[model samples]
Target: MSEPLVKEYSNGEVTIVWKPDLCIHSGICLRGLPKVFNLKQRPWVQPEKANSDQIVALVRECPSKALSVKGVRFKEKDNSDVKVTLIPGGPILIKGGATVTERNHKQVHRETVAFCRCKRSRKFPYCDGTHAQPKED
Candidate 1:
């Protein structure tokens, strides 16, 4: 497969880093703050439309590592502990210094993994944000 596309949108204070290949299209960013993530608009992301703090919070909730915030970092914490968050109708985000291995001990992402719970993701095991796509009407 080809390399994933990484896009960046900025409000000067903060930039939203988007990785389309890793995205599960959960729509959390758009739903949480439409002004910044309106799909109807050109470029789709308007980081200037919202405050950096709000944008950062929403991006952290992205199941896939697709949406991430730049220009912000928290004080060092004990990240040796693993963390997981399940989206309402999407993937499960497993993060924080994790070493994921398959049954044969083949390694996957060392720190983060987004597992598809919806079973419709073309990307399989990893989420491609397919859950966010509107079903055919």
Candidate 2:
């Protein structure tokens, strides 16, 4: 079988593992804790950003299972195929081949997909460039 695409990190407080394949790039990690999850840097996970408790809580909030924590004895896998893009004021753009199912009985076999996070897309689940609108702040 192929190798897993996950990475692990720890700072004596706790150990965190990241699975890029399952990541939806919600920006929760970076937004919640920029000190630890810096996308601008390579390897992108700084165990020192926050304590294990805080990190665990934030990781759990991820809509996707991109972030996970467990005992220190677990091993991290390699994540080379996972591509995470940070869209400005928009949902994350994931690039890969996966099965997507909708409530309208439509199944799309696509290589790329963009999810909306700004919550202003007229296309519902898909992004329709609604994030370009100004927010009330």
Candidate 3:
């Protein structure tokens, strides 16, 4: 596999790192912080529009893990106890550094992974945050 394309936007205090290849185009970032993440803008991400804490919080909600924060290191915790949470009509959030393997026996290596629940994701198995969209009657 080749190296993923990474773009970084800075606001002096913190930097927002975006990896396009990893992004499934989930609109979570835009929904979470419209001022910072504008799709129509030349540079979609404007980190300066918001503070570091707010930015980091929104980044964590990114279903694809494409949006990440730099300059802030979260302290590592003992991940012996894993947690699988259902995001209330959204995806199934798996945390605690668990290993996920596909039916084909391929192991998915990631700190966390969001499994699709509503079953409307363009990217199957993983959530692209499509569940947040309004249902068609």
Candidate 4:
């Protein structure tokens, strides 16, 4: 297996782990906390801008589960109620946690996941933010 491309940003108390490959670029992080998740910034993520608790709370809302804190696992509940959100031109986000079975027969647990609807994703079933890119004629 290939190593995933990941970046880490720390603010002493908490460290944010970013998995770009897993990100659907829904902009939830950027929109929710621009002070820390500015795209125009050099490193992109500046965890120092917000308190650790605030960052953690926002990261937990990431539908793609791309943004997470080190040593922290997503808290799961027994609620079977799931909610799906369709992002205008992006991936379909499914929240409320579920067990996703991959084509390889691997069962992965996730609090949220993004599925590609545009069919342009190189990641196949999963959205990798390809729908947001310009189409080539």
Angstrom error of the Cα, residue 115, model 4: value is 14
- Cα lDDT listed for each candidate: 0.82, 0.76, 0.85, 0.91
| Candidate 3 backbone collisions, by pair | none
Q: Tens digits of per-residue lDDT for model 3 on 1-137?
A: 88879999999988999998898976778878999999888699999999988998888778787888886655544556788898999899988766765767677787788999888999888999889888788
Instruction: Indicate which candidate wins on TM-score.
Output: 4
Mark the regions of model 3 whose C-alpha exceeds 4 Å error after superposition. Answer: 74-137
Each prediction's RMSD over C-alphas, in Å, is 13.1, 13.4, 12.2, 12.0
- Cα lDDT tens digits, model 2, 1-137, are 99878788887878788888898876778877889899887768888768877887777767777787875332344545657687987877877654566666478876777878877888878788888878666
Clashing pairs in 4: none
Candidate 2: global Cα-lDDT? 0.76
TM-score, model 2 to reference = 0.51
Query: Which window of ten consecutive residues has the lowest lDDT sum in model 4?
Result: 74-83
For model 1, the superposed segments whose C-alpha errors exceed 4 Å read 71-137
Reference-based TM-score of each model:
0.53, 0.51, 0.54, 0.59
Clash count, predicted structure 1: 3
* Residue runs of model 2 more than 4 Å from their true location after superposition: 72-137
What root-mean-square deviation over C-alphas does model 2 reach? 13.4
